[model samples]
Target chain A: MTPPILELSGLTKSYTAGGAAVAHVVGGVSLKVGRGETYGLVGESGSGKSTIGRLSLRLVEADAGTIRFGGIDLRALSGRELKRLRRRMQIIFQDPFSSLDPRVRIGTALAEPIRLHRLRRGAEVDQRVEELLATVGLSPAHRHRYPHEFSGGPRQRIAIARALAVEPELIVCDEAVSALDVSIQAQILNLLEDLQRDLGVSYLFISHDLGVVRHMAARIGVLYAGRLVEEGPAETIFADPRHPYTRMLLAAAPRLFAGPGAAPRTEIAGAPPSPFDLPPGCAFASRCPFAEARCRTEAPGPDSYRDAGRRAACWRSAELPPQAAEESTARMSPAFRRRLDLLHTARREALA
Target chain B: MSETPPAQDADTSAPVLSIRDLTVRFGQAAPVLDGIDLDIGRGELLCVVGESGSGKSVTALAAMGLLPPAAQISATRMMLGDKAGDVDLAGLGERQLERLRGNRMAMVFQEPMTSLNPVMTIGRQIAEPLIRHHGLDAGEARTRALEMLRQVHVPAPEQRYAQYPHQLSGGLRQRVMIAMALVCRPALLIADEPTTALDVTIQSQILRLIDELRAELDTAVMFITHDLAVVSEIADRVAVIYAGRIVEEGRRAQIFEDPQHPYTLSLFASMPRLVAEDVSGGGRLAPIGGQVPAPGNMPAGCRFAPRCPFAVTRCMAEVPPLAAPAGSAGDGHRVACWRAPLEETLG
Candidate 1:
């Protein structure tokens, strides 16, 4: 088998307060992003999904772990060599407004990465920048606008173009589309898919939004208090999530059309355990509906669901009752569905 | 426009809070809320949903009479059925509005951390409204605040009472905000994206809490959100706002099930479905280009026409009136687009 584009094993990171490791932001996470595959790292805020993304890119140094980028050990590499390897990896943050330089033209922002990587030079560099803009569906005229001059959606497209300028094989999209409105988010999502289809770039897509993640990712990793609780194909996980936390996320996601009547979305009672003083058990055990005495005392290893790639960090996942496939969109009334069909067809015909 | 701005049943009864042709602009800018009318019954959960700068929050602030003094506000009618009787909120002086605020009408903002008093104990903050509005003594106010906290289901209300806003979690601070807002049992509660900042699980809990409180207190709730999914879950009626206009307004079923406006339909098509995609995959979200125009620089005709998939010359020239389609029972399902009932026109 081809080596995964990026692989992390036993990745751990803790933020220190006053030189003491007071908070374990990321604790013992392991995952693999296959070549050109979108690996979704999903969790609530402070769950350390972002930390893992940063760790993979070596943006945040992990306290302990092995990071292999296309078979090269990132941890053992020297700083200078790591800097060079950085050319092959890039990141897009949630907010392009702040992530971008206010004073710089959008064209300069895109050119800086290309020039730094020496992907293009002189007249060719300017030409490449224009090409990048066109690639992201932006006009060359937009290259002259400042970051603040553009709206949220366009600003994000500029960010994406910047990410693409480096010609990286893998881009860590840390909540890239989370800030945009629904319609705008759809545009960006489609753009990302198109870019992936054309460029064959892998993405470590980290988002707190499950729906967006479900749409963008082929494989998913559920994070809880800095721990990876579940990792599996997006379809199987959504169809019948093995882990309680995964099920909780599925239950909590706001669905537009959940059959004819509105269904009351459920929430589990407790907050995630503090990373400062984690229990000597599953990080989600406190909130897990099926947690037992053993689950509260002993940390369980990854329980294999089926293939080597599918697993849940729960002692009872194998014996747990199967979750009914959660209801979501497309339960439209016939009238609504008919109208939507007409809308889709008309929009398509016009675009065509 | 012969028709009045389309109106909802307001939960099948007389409106607890009614506003008509409300227009607001700051300084020399264009109106942020352009002739938008809204109604909320005694216990209705009306959701005003739109993207950023769509006048969702401004509408709430305008109704609460909380806009800054610089806002040049005008309205045909802004009536609130306060305990005192029906009062025109627009007619009230700032001082009069202040008296009615937190007493007869309350607001809960998106970020409770900012909306809440950071320096004050959560308990004191909650008790202040009771003391100010109900004329309760400090001790009585404290007791009532604790009860309110409990009602909002804040764990360990006694301990939380002594905690500052910074000491509590995001969800807890939100609960404190709700406790404070509802302590005086206001006639109307305007929650503007109250859960947008929270995690999904926490957001669901807060939404559930608001739904319960709205039901129990019969507080006419104006829930402003950009999330159509959230609207589907909690709204009794929904008003889809765009560029300060209510482009479409209808019952939740009518809006979600049989929306007619191109903007509303596009919004529905644009959202990525949550889970069903796994079961039946091969689906793509409709891509509607163009951002919501800034208030001061809105388009001439249909606000959404710039990005509309089916826009024609007429859409660019004529501002479609917010009215029911050509032939339909006037079920308060109004749409502001020339190509309504798209199945008929497009198909």
Candidate 2:
């Protein structure tokens, strides 16, 4: 297997707000992003998923741990060296409306990144900006427009164009498509997939939406209370999650169209333990339906199970209540399916 | 939980609230919502599904008589309850509307933090409605507020009652919001993307809570959301809104099983499947090209015609009336598309 583009081991971070107790937002979390791979990091709000995304890019300095990007230890790099390395990594925020400067034209936003990185000069920089606009499926005419002039989708496109201007090797997309509507989300997802295929770029795809994460990533990592609970192939994890938290997430997620045989999702009644005072044991034990006595007293490390490629941090990973094996179908009508088929054809022809 | 909450089977004849030919515009500009019609059935959940700028929220605000004074609003027949207890929301004055609002109908918005007063205790915030609308005294209102909080499943209701909005977590705060909205047990409840700001885990629970509350209170619910999954999860009936118009309406089964409108079809196509693979192979969704038409830039004919793949000359030149197709099951499923029965016409 090829080496991962980004790797973190024993990543830890803490924040003390308003002279209160220090909260370990991320604690000893370890993960990797392989070259030309989309690694999905998914968890609910305050689960440290976003923290990991920022830490990987050195946007926030970790209190302790090692960050290796393409075999270079990021912690050892000086400010100048780190600034040079920033060219290879970019981050896209959730809100496109607030991310860009409203007064700045889209052209200036795209050009600034290229010029700052010194990737291009005068006319070449402008030319590259136009190319980027085209790359994200926008027109060069849109260059003159301000952020307010563009809609959510176009603004997001501009954000993407700016990210690509420096030709980053890996991009951390933190809930990138969560803000847009469904159709626009599809467009952005498709565009990202296309860009990955064409540019051979990697993405550290962070989102709370499992459907979006599953759509983007080949492998998935589930985080809970700043800890890595499970990591595996998307299909395997989605089909049969070893970690109880992972299963809870799947059950909570609403299917677009559910068939009659679909299993009822098992809901976790209480909220996650407070980040400031997380219990010593597994962070999900309180919510786990099959939690054993040891789960509350002893913390479990990320242990391999099912296969070497799959891992779950659970004491009772071996013995849990069996899941209803019914594969929920879309319950799609033949009539509806035909229209979808027609849509694919029409869209293809339109592209042609 | 298992979805389809048994769809309360609300009676059509005596709907809790009904609006016909509702049109809304802002200060001489183009109409934001034009000729909108909807019916909130007694004890049934009707989801108004549309993207941003599609006027779903505007429709709700107009119904509640909450639209700004500068806004121009007109409707042929907008009333609550079909029988002798009917209240004409369109013709009512602000003072009359205020009395009818919390007493007859109430609305919940996306963010509880914005609507909820941070300075006020959770208990007091909830008690305000009871005091103002029901004339409940201080002691009675306080007791009722705590009871309301407990009903929405907030833990340790007594402890929570004393705390302010900022002290509670988002889920608990939202439970507070629901408690405040339903404190009066109003006949009609309009929740506009109430769960959109929350996580999926919290979102489903809130949806279930709302579903449970609607059934218990027998309040007609107009649940507005952009998510098709959430819509299918909780809706008894579905209304597809596009560019300020109802393009389709149907029962949950009818809408999911046999969608007819091109926009609905496109929305279904656009959704990312939860399963391992879908039509475009893994991870890819079929995007509907272009955006929802901005207000002033709306097409003269069909609003969706510009982005629609099936757009024809007739579609661009004239608006198609929303009506049931010839072979459709008795009036339940309707579509506003010139080229519907698409398999026969286009295939």
Best TM-score among the predictions, by candidate number? 2
State which candidate has the highest DockQ: 2
Tens-digit per-residue lDDT, A66-179, candidate 1: 999999999999999998999999899989876789999998888998888788879999999999999999999998889988888888999899889989999999999988
Let me know the TM-score candidate 2 reaches against the reference structure.
0.97
DockQ of each: 0.48, 0.61
Q: Name model 1 segments beyond 4 Å from true.
A: A19-21, A258-267, A304-308, B1-13, B26-30, B274-282
Residue pairs clashing in model 2 are: none
Tell how far residue A172 is off in model 2, in angstroms. 0.4
Interface RMSD, all candidates in order, equals 5.8, 2.4
Give candidate 1's error at residue B259 in angstroms. Answer: 1.1
